[model samples]
Target: MVMAFRKKPTSVIRTKASKPKTPTNWLHLIKPMLMFLCLLFAYVMYSNWSSWLALLDKTPIRAYALTHKTQFTTNSDIRDLLSKEPVLKGYFGQDIQEIKDKFLEIPWIKDVAVRKVYPDRISLTLVEHRPTAIWNQTRFVSAQGVVFDLPKERFNADGLPELYGPDSEAKKVLEAWYKIQKDLESRNLVLKSVAMDIRGSWTITLNNHVELRLGRGDWLPKIDRFVTIFPEIEIPDGKRLSYVDLRYEHGAAVGFISQ
Candidate 1:
């Protein structure tokens, strides 16, 4: 006998429908509001700028206090010097940089400290340059080899040796003078002046008023040779040492002043 089984009904499938996604609102980026704060701050500063300036103007500087560690810059001198500046023009609106530049214009001033004394005063502290020599008979040289002009006339040589050179060669001249001076002083000789001519030839004058011509090249060796022979060299009792030309390769030729 043939037997056939009947199929059971298929089970139904079911699932819940998914909700649609909404588009992102990019305008909501102001949630932290940082950009808004920046805009507000800029607006306030722009609107109140002139008012702040006026307020600062009302508090004009009435007095000045100056402190300095220097011999040439006295409190009174600084007072008289800076009084002419517009530093006291307005409390904060006036040019502080201009005042500083004016202070630096003084040949002796090396550095400066500036501050405002709250209610009515401007205060400054200064450092002065240590002068090494006088340059070209008109300007002063600092120990660091900078050349600057003095505001007042220095008629007195003040015993500082004079250095002469082209404006661009001041530092080179100073270095040469220092080295030459040290070597001469080692031999108990006084170096009074050192000069570099336009042709780049160098000459040094001793305290005895004798000049040494070390022309156009390395001069230290020539200086050494001269100082070595200086003490024992025999000079006629009546003739004074005038000049020694060290330009030659083999030896130096001594010269005497015309009788």
Candidate 2:
């Protein structure tokens, strides 16, 4: 039975095929890490630069120079001003705008330009106010109608025409003065001073020491009449005209100087 028996058919075992192992791309793996390192290095450099700048700011200003546009302001004045603020910050760290504002606070300075130079130096360009007339007793007025005052010793107001008025009316008074002066010149009269009282009353002092009183009415007409009649007015020998009152409607009242 064993010799002639057919062998049972054996089932074949099949194994799955293995996939190929691909090599890793080294460049792709290292690129992101390299980028991160570069970014970190740049940040560190920027931080160091900021720290250097901060340290430089702590260094004090070593030298300062001023350029004056006019002789109205003196070097001593500028030095005195600087002396008050002895410890100006470093040139690179200074607040230029703040320095300009402080310079403008000086009565004689009208405009100021501040600059920081290298190696701890600062330069200032100063434009001073030119006095065109004496405003009241303590102030000065410029041709541009700027009113300012400096120390009494810094300026000489001897020859300047004295102007008096409310602070708010400075520009108006200055404009009126120019017109009045031109009109008065045609009559051979020189205007020495002008004043406006709180009541808005106007008065002018001539070079010959005569005063003209122009009230709050229409002063233009009054001024015209005076200019027309001024040349014809007679003065006695050894006596000058003292004052002319122009507040009237038609004509003005003239008074002679008593001998």
Worst 10-residue lDDT window for candidate 1 reads 148-157
Output the worst ten-in-a-row residue range by lDDT, candidate 2: 12-21
The lDDT values for all models are 0.78, 0.80
Candidate maximizing lDDT:
2
In model 1, what lDDT does residue 68 have? 41
Q: What is the total number of backbone clashes in candidate 1?
A: 0
Residues 52-93, model 2: lDDT tens digits = 565677576667787645576676766666656634666555
Give candidate 1 misplaced runs (Cα > 4 Å): 1-41, 44-53, 74-77, 80-87, 90-95, 151-157, 186-188, 224-239
lDDT of 1 by residue, 1-259 (tens): 9999999999766544554567998768765587888989999989987567757676666687766455677667777767774546656555567678878877677888778766667788888766678888878887787887665453354898799988788888888887887877777888999999889999999887889999988887888778766776667767878988889886788876543
Q: Each candidate: RMSD to true structure?
A: 7.1, 7.7
